[model samples]
Target: MKKIEAFVRHESFDAIRARLADMGLPSMSISEVKGSGRQGGYTESYRGAKTTIFMRPKLKLEMVVNDADVERAVDVILELAHTGEPGDGKIFIIPVEDTVRVRTGERGEIVLASHPDDA
Candidate 1:
């Protein structure tokens, strides 16, 4: 299994989720995060004064998918999140050694594939 973590713009999050749902990839973890990458942070006007924000607001999306689906998932994120500008965000792919369902105690892919509607 592979874990896909994507840090995307706040405004694009809703569209990203909707598109993922359409692709049967609704299960995910999302959080409001703040960070900076290559372009670094930016300056904004605060009460008519220039203020630098080192960490900007972003949406962190995380989900696990089969190896075969990695490319598709990445593509979805890229297509939706791309803004042709800085702070567009980044995606990270990591290896997931294992997973266990708390209630059923099922392991690995079995746990991942068991959606609530099927239970």
Candidate 2:
């Protein structure tokens, strides 16, 4: 099993989510996050003054799936979230020892099968 974590631009959330669903990769956790990358943050002007914004808002998506689905999931996220620009975000894949379905007590591959990773 594997856990996939992706931090993407806030504005791309809807498109990414829709693409994930279309690929049959459902059951994900989404969170609003703030961070900066190579581009760092930018400066904004207000009331004839400029202020530096160090942290940019982003959307973080996390999910656990079978190891075999890792590549496909990553591809889907990259394709949908990429804007060919800096601060586009990144994806991380980690090993997942096991998983359980709280409602049915399903475990491991059984739970994974319920959430098909068909990207």
Candidate 3:
């Protein structure tokens, strides 16, 4: 199994979510995150005062998928998240040792299967 973590622009969330859903990959954890990368920070003016903001708001999406599905999931994210600009965000793929279902005590790749209750 593999865990895919993608940090994307806040405005791109909806479209990315929709496309992932269309690809039968609707299950994921989304979190509001603040981060800084090569783009660094930008300056903004308010009331004639210039302020430098170091942390930019982004959406972090996390999904665990079967080993065979890693590329498919990553492609979906890349297709929707690309902007050809800095701060377009990043995607990290990590090996998942195992998964467990709390209720049924299920483990391993079998836990990746969709459960009716998960809907």
Candidate 4:
């Protein structure tokens, strides 16, 4: 199993979610996050003062998929999340040791594939 963590522009969340769902990988966790990449954020002017904002809002999306699905999952994220501009964000794939479904106490990749409807 592998965990796919994507930090993307907030506006891209819905489209990405819909696309991933269509791919049968609907299970995911999302969080509002703020960070900067090579662009390093920007500056704004208020009255006669200028403020440099180093942190920008983004959506952190995380999902676990079977090892075989890792490339496909990453492809969906890359295709939907790219904007050809800075602050478009990044994707990280990490190793998942195991997964357990809380209610049934079932474990491993099987747990990830089980949806509530499967109960």
| TM agreement with the true structure for every prediction | 0.88, 0.85, 0.89, 0.93
Off by over 4 Å in 2: 115-119
How many pairs of residues collide in model 4?
Answer: 0
Off by over 4 Å in 1: 45-49, 114-119
lDDT of 1 by residue, 1-119 (tens): 99999999989999999998887788799999888887755799988999887988889999998777789989999999998998899999999999888887888876666376742
Report the C-alpha lDDT of model 3 over 22-71, residue by residue, as the tens digit.
Answer: 77677799999898887757899999999999998889999999887889
Q: Any residue pairs clashing in model 2, and if so which?
A: none
lDDT by residue (20-69, candidate 4, tens digit) is: 88878889999998888887657899997999999888899999999988
Which candidate wins on TM-score?
A: 4
lDDT string for model 2 (1-119, tens) is 88999999888888877877776677799999998777756899999899999998889999888877789889888888888988889998888888888988888877876544344
**Model 4 lDDT at residue 30:** 98
Model 2 accuracy (lDDT, Cα): 0.84
Query: Model 1, 32: alpha-carbon shift in Å?
Result: 0.4
The models' CA-based lDDT, in order, is 0.88, 0.84, 0.88, 0.88
- Give residue 107's lDDT in candidate 1 (0 to 100): 89
